[model samples]
Target: MELCFFDQVKAQPLWVQILLVVGTISILKFSFAVLNWVYVTFLRPGKNLKKYGSWALVTGPTDGIGKSFAFQLARKGLNLVLVGRNPDKLKEVSDGIQAKFGKVQIKSVVVDFSGDLTEGIRKIEEAIEGLDIGVLINNVGISYPYARFFHEVDEQLLKNLIQINVEGTTKVTQAVLPGMVKRKKGAIVNIGSGAAIVIPSDPLYAVYAATKAYIDQFSRCLYVEYKKSGIDVQCQVPLYVATKMASIKRSSFLVPSTDGYARAAMRWIGYEPRCTPYWPHSLLWALVHMLPEYAVDAWRLQFCLAVRKKGQLKDSRKKE
Candidate 1:
C-alpha cells in the first residue's frame, strides 16, 4: 500500500521532522518581529510625561540634543531643570522655555562636567532639593575633537571624555535616583551613540565609543534593578544628528535636526532599555548589521580617515 503525503511526512527521519518544526517557528518569529517593528515605528502610543513626574532635569541643555530635550519636555507640560557648562546658555534656555510655556517652571544649573564633578554634583543635588524631578536626561557627553587613532589622542581630550561621559553620567544619575526610588516612579534617559551600537567597530573614535558602551550597560543594569521600583532606565542610541558635536551642519533624512531627534526621543522614554528613536536611523542600524564584518570595518576606517583629515586641516587653519 502506498503511503499518503501526510503519512510519508510523519514517517520521515526524526531529524527531518525537527528541522521542519524549527523552520516553521523561525518563520513565525521573523514575522512577529516585523509586525512589532511596524507597530513601534508608527502605531504605538507614547506614555504621558506627567505620569512619570511633575519636573524633568536635563543635563547639557545649552545646545544640541540636550537643548532640544529641554524644550520638548517643557512642551509636554513638565517643568524643567536645565543643566549645562555655560551659565549664560543655561539661563537663556530656561528663559526661552519659560517664555514659550507660560505655566511651566524653569531652573538653570551651571556645572561643567569636565571640572570638579563632586562640586558640580553637589550643586545639582542642591538645585533639585524639594523638587519632584520625575525625568532625568543624562545627556551631557563629550567626543573627540575629531577622529584620531587611540595613540594619537591628546591627554586632555582623553581625560575630558572619560570624566564628562562616564563619570558625569554616573554621578548625575546617582544624584537623582534616590528621589525616584522614594517616589517609585521616574524615567532616566541616557544619550548613547550609534558608533558604539550600530557599527562593527568605531575605528578612530575608540574612547568615545567605549564610554557610550559603558552607558548602554549601565542603563541596562539599572533598568533591571529598578523595574520593580517603578523606575525606567533607557539608553537612546543615535547614529548622527545635525549638531555641532557631530560636525553635521545640515539635517537630512538620515541625520535629523536636534529638535527632530528629541521629539522622537521623548516619545520613546519609559519604554525600552535600549532604543534607536529615529525611525530612519533604526533602518540604517538594521542595514549596517546586515553587512559583513570586514565590509563594515573597511567603511568605518575610510570614514574616520576623512574626519581626521578635515580636523587636521581645521586645526592648521586655526593656528595660522
Candidate 2:
C-alpha cells in the first residue's frame, strides 16, 4: 500500500480553514468587505426623524448620492439648498428638484471643494449670508483615479482628498454648528462609506479609506457630545452607492443605486443614531467581522489581481 503524503490530515485546523475561505472570498468578492462593514457599523439603530430641519443645506449636491439626498429632502417638504463645485450640474439637479417638488424652495450654491476648503466654505457663508441655516448635510467626497495607489498619488490629489474628506467637512460643520446649537434644533448627517469601518488592506484606495475612517470616528463623537442640545449628528455608511464614485464596479451586490442610498439616508432623518441604509446586509457583515487580520490581508491580494492595469487606451475606465 502506497501512503500519499498530500492526503494526510490537513496542516491547518478546521477553524483556520474556515477563516481562510472567508478571507479569500472577501478579497475576491467585494460583497465580503461591504457586508462586513454593514454589520460592524450599521447595526446601531437611529433617532427620531420626524423633526427635520426646514432649511436644509446639502454639499456635493451635483453628483452621485448627494444629488439624490437634496432631491429627497425637497420631496419631504424641506426647503433645500444644493451645494457643490460645479455650477452647471448644480443648476441641473436644482431645476429637476424644483420641477418635481415645485412648491419647495430650492437654491444652488457652487464652490470648489478641492480648493482651500475654508475659503470655499466662506463663499457658502456668503451664499446664505447668515439666514439662520438649519440642517447641514456634509456630503462632498472624491476618490481620485482608481489606478493611483497611496505612494503613487500626486501631491495635488492627496491634498484634494484631504480637503474634501477632512477639512471641507470640518469647516462646513464648524460654520453651521453654532447656529444649530444656538437655535437648539438641527441635524448634521455626514455621508460616509463602508470603507471607513472595514479599512481594507487593498492599496488601490488606501487614502480614500483613511479619509472615511476620520468621518466615522468624527461623527460618532459629535453625536455623543451634542445630542443633549437637540443637535443630531449621524453617519450613513452605505455600500458603494453608484455615483461618480462608482468608477470601480457598477452593479455588484456591494454597489447599489444612489437613489437607494438616498432613500436609506432619509430613514435616518431623525436618526436612531447610526444605521446602515440596507438592513439585510447585516448577515454578510457579521461573518466578515469574525475574520482574523492575517487572513484578511492575504484575501486582499486576490482583490489586487482582479483589478490590475489592463492599460486599455481605447476608453479609460473613469466616467465623466
Candidate 3:
C-alpha cells in the first residue's frame, strides 16, 4: 500500500521523527498563542460595571492613569469615589466627571498614601460606608524621581515607596474587601508595572520593581481566594504610559496616553489575574521576553544608567 505522510514520517529515522514531532508541537503552540492574543485584543466583550455594582473607587485619581480611570469609569455609568492626596485636585477631577457625565454621583476622599495611612485609611472606610463599591483601583503609588543604585536610595524614598505601594494597597484592599465579600461581587484592579513582570529584571530601580512584584503576587493570591465569592482581582501591568510619573511628555505608539491606556484597561478588568491590557504594549512585552536574559539585563542596565545621568544633571542645574 502507498504510504501516507504520517506513515512516511514513521518510516524515517528515529531522530528525524522526533525532530518533526517537536517542530509540529512548537508550531501548534505558537499558533494558539496568536489566536488567543487576537481574541483578547479585539473580540472579547468587557463585563458590565453595573453588574458588579454602581460605585467604583479609584485611588490617585488626580493625575496620570488614575485620573483617566476615574473618567472612564464615570463614562461607564458608575458612580465614583475619587481618592488622592490633594483635595483640590480630587475635587477638580470629580467636577470634571460630573460636568461631562451629568447625573453621575461623585465623591472625593483625601488620603496621602505616603503619610500616616492609619487616619487616611479610616477616612476611606468612612467615605465608602454603606455604599456598594463594586470596583477598587489600587492605583496610588510612588516611584523614584530617577533610577539610582540600591545603596544610593535615601531613607525617605525607600520608606515612601514601601508605605505607599505595598502597605497602602494592602490596607485599601482590606478596607473594601469586606464589603465585596459580604455582597458577593466585586472587582479589584491593582496597577503593576512591566519592571516587575515583562523584563528579566530591573537593574537600578530595585525597590520600586520589588514593590510592584509584591502587587503582582498579592493580586494573584486574592484572585484565587476571592473568585468563589464572585470577586475578580487582577494586577494590570503596563510598560509605559505618557504620564508625569514616567516623565514622558508625549505619547507614542509604544507609550499610550493616560486616557488611551485607561480605556484599554477597563475592558480587561475582572478578567485575568495578570494582564498587559494595552495591545501594542503586549507585542513589545512579547518581543522583550523573546530576547536572551543576558541581553535584556544589559539593555536595562544601560538604559537606567542614562536615566541616572540625566537626573543628576538636572539636579546640578537646579543647584546652580
Candidate 4:
C-alpha cells in the first residue's frame, strides 16, 4: 500500500496535470463571469444624462488623461476648472486653451489631492462656488514606489494613492453629486484600466490597478443608484494608454495614446458603463477578456509581479 501511494504521487500522469490546470481555469472563468454579472446587472445601475450642463471641473488637468479631457472638453465649448498640483503646468495648459478657443473660462487650482486630501477637496468646493457645476471628472491619480509587494509599498505614498484614488474621488463625487441630484442632471466619468478587467500578475502597479478596479466598481454602483435622479456615472475602462502612470508597460501595441482615449471618452460621455473606445480598443479588451481565465490571470501576474526589481518613483530631475 505504501509503495502504491508513492508511485501514484510520483507519477501523477501528464494528462492528470493538464486536467488539473484546465479545471482550475474553468473555475476561474466561472468566477469571472459571476463578477461581470454582479457588476453589470445586480451591482450597479446604468445611469444616463442627456444634459450635463456647462461648468465642468476636471481634476488631474495638468497631465496625461486629465490634460486630454481638458483640451477635448474645451474644444467642445465647456468652461474648465483645472485641478492639479502644478500651477505652472496648469497655467500652460490654460494658456494653450485660450490661444486656440479664444478664452474658454479657464481656471486652475494648485492643489495636490493626495496631500491633505480632505482640505484640498474642501478648497475645490469653495473655489467653484456660485456655479451650478454639472460635470465632475475625477482624473487626478498616480502609481509608483514599487519596492515590495502590496504590503511593502511606501506607507506614505500608498496612503497618498489611496487618498487621491479612493478618498478624494469619493469626496469630490459626493460633493458634486448633490448639485446634480438637486438639479436632476449631472455627469460623472471615472477613468479605469484594462488591468481591472483581469487580475494582473504584474506587481508593478498592483495597488494602482486595484484602485482603478475599485473606481470601476464604485462608478457602476453610483450609476445604478443615481440613474433615476438624472445623474450619469460612467466607468470608462480603456487599456494601458501611453501615460506617465504606466511607464513600465510601454509597448507600441499595448499602449494607446492620450488623444485616442480622449476621443473615445467623448463618445462614451453620452453613454453609460462603457468598457469603451469600442471600435479598436474594445477589440483588444475583448480578446483579453475572452482568453481563458488562468491564462489571463497568469499574464497579468507575469507582467506585474516582475516589477519589484525596477527602481522606485522619482521626481523629474530636468532643470526647468
**Candidate 1, after superposition: displacement of residue 38 in Å?**
0.9
Go through the candidates in order and give the C-alpha RMSD of each one to the true structure.
2.1, 9.8, 1.2, 10.5
lDDT of 1 by residue, 1-320 (tens): 35686688799999999998899999999999999999987889889988888999999999999999999999999998888889888888888888999899988888988888999999999999998999999999999989999999989999999999999999999999999999999999999999898887999999999999999999999999999999999999999999999989999999999999999998899999999999999999889978999999998899899999999999999999
TM-score of 2: 0.78
By TM-score, is 3 or 4 better?
Answer: 3
TM-score for each candidate, following the candidate numbering: 0.96, 0.78, 0.98, 0.77
Runs off by more than 4 Å, candidate 1: 1-5, 11-15
Per-residue lDDT tens digits of candidate 4, residues 11-70?
888888778779989999989976874564334533232257777889899888889888
Q: Residue 164 in model 4: shift from native, Å?
A: 1.0
Candidate numbers sorted by TM-score from highest down: 3, 1, 2, 4
CA shift at 196, candidate 4, in angstroms?
A: 1.7
Instruction: Estimate the lDDT of model 2.
Output: 0.73
Cα displacement (angstroms), candidate 1, residue 135, comes to 0.3
Give per-candidate clash totals. Answer: 0, 11, 0, 11
For TM-score, the strongest prediction is 3
**Alpha-carbon lDDT of model 1:** 0.93
